[model samples]
Target: MNYEKYYPIVYKQLYYLVGNNELAEDLTQEVFIKYYNSKEQIEFLGAWLSKVAANIAFNYLRGEKRRIKREENILEEVNNIFSIEDEIFRSEQIKEVRKILVNIPDKQRVCLILKFSGYSYEEIHNATNIPLNNIGQFIARGKQKFVKLYKKEGEINVL
Candidate 1:
């Protein structure tokens, strides 16, 4: 029923979180499996599914999977028309941004990542269990912390 409707939404959320196609697909399957097993007791299916997906992605990120990529194919992404030096610089920036995203506090980090991934504030709140009123605050704080860490990362050559 709604599975056909919400599957892509959940999958896209996970894809944005993990940035790896296979992993996102696997995690999305896991989310739906959990939902299927517990569908009766649930009230709001979309919110429940979103929250579960976020938690699973967060747990995966917290583990050794922190080395995960944000894209399925590096070559495909890099094939864009850009100079060698520009590509290299962009690569370094992406690496540093990933590192900073990992280091930020969980709430802030999730908000920033979801927002960056194109989720609306309402969707971010649904997925994160963050209140609508405070989503903006966390996002702002996340950006500040990210900029602060990025500057330090650049100085220390963190990559």
Candidate 2:
């Protein structure tokens, strides 16, 4: 089987399922491993992998304690990957942004991450199923809130 051919499909599927690139990437790898072992029985390999990944992701999400711990673990891993110093700096910004983001609502937070990560409005719309017009509003509000939070924190640190 041509695993490489389906890699992007698996990635997109998992990304759509999880809405987080890092977690989607991890789940994608797990999905491919399952596919490797069960390839013979799987017809429409792409769909099979997607179903498996979604099931796994959904199960993971259903457990609140597990999900919270997993998020902490993931954030720790992300921190490690970026190096301690860089992680600390980025985390400070992200923490402030997250606090402000909570006030923006879920869709806006998704839009904020997608846009901040460099996706275009169209791309965010496609990925998130959010309306095109609203992407701008979400991003605008999210950015403004983040800027305010960041500036406020910066002022406190300067004193």
lDDT top scorer? 1
Best-matching candidate per TM-score: 1
- lDDT tens readout by residue for model 1, 7-122: 99999999999999999999999999998787378878899999999999999988744444534356456766356768899898788789888999999999999999999999
* TM-score of every prediction relative to native: 0.44, 0.39
Candidate 2 lDDT, 1-159, residue by residue in tens: 777898898888778877889988888898888877773776677778778888877875677568898999999898787798787888987787676677766887899989989999999999999989889998888778777777877798799
Deviating ranges (above 4 Å) for candidate 1: 1-82
> Per-residue lDDT for 78 in model 2?
89
TM-score of 1: 0.44
Scored against the true structure, residue 102 in model 2 reaches a CA lDDT of: 73
Please give the lDDT score at residue 74 for candidate 2.
100
**Full-model lDDT for every candidate:** 0.89, 0.82
Pairs of residues at least 3 apart in sequence or in different chains that clash in candidate 1: none
